[model samples]
Target chain A: MNMRCTKARRYLSQAMDEQLPPAVTRQLDEHLDACRECRDFREDLALGRRLLGATEPSLSGNFDWRLQLKLNQALQKAAGETAYPWLEEKPRGRGWAGNFTTAAAFGLAAVLALAMFIGPQGRVMPDDAGRYAGFETSRQVAGGVSDRLPLNRGALAPLSAPRGIQRSVSGSFGLGDFSPNAAFVLDSGWSGNHLKDLATIQELKLRNQRLNNQLYQYQQQISILRRQLDRPDSNGLDLGR
Target chain B: MNPSRDEHRHGSPSAARFDLVETRDEDLIVMVQDGNRKAFDELAARYKNRLFSFILRMVKEPVLAEELTQETLIRVYIHAGKYREIAKFSTWVFTIATNLVRNKMRQRSRRPQLLSLNPAPADDEIPLDPADPVADPSEEIQRRELALVINEATAAIPEKYRIPFLLREVEQLSYEEIQQVTGLKLGTVRSRINRARNRFRQLIKPLLKDETLLAELEMIEARVAEQKDNPS
Candidate 1:
């Protein structure tokens, strides 16, 4: 066959499928009209299409039954798969080390929570010198305290000794890798709900300050009564001075 | 393409008013994307035979074909969310099937099994047309012979040619659809299909020179030509 016949026949199958543009169909039809060889080739593709299209087998004998079983298993497997995106299937693998890390993360969160609760109370169980002591500040000194508590400083400091890993650990837990303070403080993190937390902590500091004044006054009265008991009076019986 | 069909596909509230059976494949696939298992089953029901037959012919083994067909459907279910409506659902499905078949073919090429020691099972062989069954006794014999010839001719074609050929001839995909499915350039698709059809015609046409079926094939071809020339 000539080159035109060769080119025309390439599009014949497409023409049969109605896939060709109308212009090409017209050209192919014109070519087929002139060329018996190309016509026969077009006939061949049609015959092949009919013959091969007929050979599509029915899905006989338990095909659906087997597919249903497999589909169910696949569904179960998919449902069981974790929805959360993780860097690894077993994030660094579960063992003592992983367990310890998880424990440390929770422990750090608990300490932060405790500090948030107790910081404004102004009652330190221990001092920076590592001595058990109580503050004996004058009432004049008490009025100078700030409305907001001091920076978390020591409470927020290097818990678990690895700052970077803490962020990732919470990240893996879907706690969001925000600022370090937000990581543990969670709902009360400064990045979120800060105004509400500030109001709460400020109120607690004021209440504690008032309670401290009362405690100081009562301590002063007890000291005075002790001094009176110790004093020598004209008709005084020494009552266990 | 219709506005009403658009409403159903876009997951509008009105979509719920229509039975999923009335829904188009693209819309049904949208439902599938929304985690509708029933919609997935509807799609599976529609295409299982086509997928099974295509894979069966490609792999030339019934059990493997069945497995691959199931794999393709399950994948459609599992990854339905990833299917964007940029192409026809059939195109997306065939692309996935083609990938699986390609991978299987690659693995099989490495550790090629030279032959099956046992005789080919009769149940699993290329079957005669069930739709055209219980015909004239002599006609039945001719039909089976034609089917066998066609199957052999097609099986003999090279993989590159055979895939696009079957997709074009059997699955009736457009040239662009064939390109999408095979990841072949459009030029490559046209050329390969032409080559495949050439080989197929050469192989099967010469073999059917027997007196009985040649007349019938000729008549069919003539009717096809007549229909093409005289549009109703």
Candidate 2:
């Protein structure tokens, strides 16, 4: 082998790695002596190796402190967030107990509500059927009364104004006079023996009015209940009053 | 010489020691797994400075390097059980470090577009205070200038070559050990190092004047001699 060629090949990897053999070392020395280009190449290689060696960047300052601080934080986080082995190993019976208590309380509340609304006195009577029929008639009357009175008033509104006065007025005159409370106030607190007979008549009339109001409320609730029940998946919803 | 049982047997001691040290890494991991705070502290004391330097070099930004280093340790703790003894512990640790830096670079590339919505930070605004204060001003300036040149040149090298270059040149990993770390063929590792050195020479030629290069080498030799003499 040509010594120059051997030297040139050897010079490619010789800065200060002690692992290089003596023959290769001798070749590198000889090449550096002869060739300026090879010599310059070796120098550049040596410089890069040196600079990179120094560039580890001491990390003694806050940068390193901050890093250790972070490592501690990470260790802490790992310790904290680790899944409890017992959770997977042991059954979670507490959840089942909580669910049981919630379900029992709900069932108890529903039974109590059922007792209040639909038990004994709350039971349906023949009079209730009659009252329901009377309620239907009253609804029809109210709806017709509203339709005849004005275009804007609700269908279930009561009539209080004189039919003649309602016909003449227009432009957002309120149906406030049509409220059951307003009408009930007029019927309540008036008296005399001729007026007691008149008062008895008025009391009977007010009783019918109250019964109508109660019936109307019950009907509205029943309709809402019916609509809810008609739904395929009501999910046992309770529409509390 | 063709390799034989005797040579392999001789090699086994260091390999056994490697296994022993690896068990230490595992023990540290197990302590972390067991939630031993003291063990974590000991582990941190042992590996913190070295890992920080490794990550800092790989990522090239102090804050990001610190972040990756922290993340790697945390990962080691969290994934202690997953750490099989298939490779040396240091190799595995560096592998984790290398992956994090690569991921960070990828994330940065993705972020530039997203960050267009936000005002960009000024180049000088990102602080990079070198932890060591150089005793000589000339050496300091030269070191900084050299770092800049090397950083640019290193980008041109292929990643395969770059990893080994960083591992061997920057990290000082030995040839056989780097082979063990990287799982590269020995011949492949040797050739790549040779090529890496060649590429580095080509890259630095523009920045380093002839006399300046010689002076740097002389300083390295002097430093090496001093370190040997002191042996602290």
Candidate 2 clashes between residue pairs 3 or more apart in a chain or in different chains: A192-A196
How far does residue B132 in candidate 2 sit from its true spot (Å)? 5.7
Ten contiguous residues minimizing lDDT sum, candidate 1 chain B: B1-10
Error of 1 at B217 (Å): 7.2
Q: TM-score of every model? A: 0.57, 0.49
- TM-score: which candidate is best? 1
Which residue pairs in candidate 1 collide? none
Model 2 agreement with the true structure over B212-231: per-residue lDDT tens digits? 76576567557656766976
Per-residue CA lDDT of model 1 for B98-126, tens digit only, reads 89998999999997876776566566343
Residues A1-241, model 1: lDDT tens digits: 2238667877876677676898788877788888998877777667666667544455755666677788899875553343222222565558898899899999998787667535643444445644323212211123332222224544323232333322111111112343254433222212113576576557545544544555556765764554343222313234577
Instruction: Provide DockQ values for all models, in the order shown.
Output: 0.14, 0.14
Residue B156 in candidate 2, Cα distance off native in Å: 3.5
- Model 1 Cα displacement at B22 (Å)? 1.8
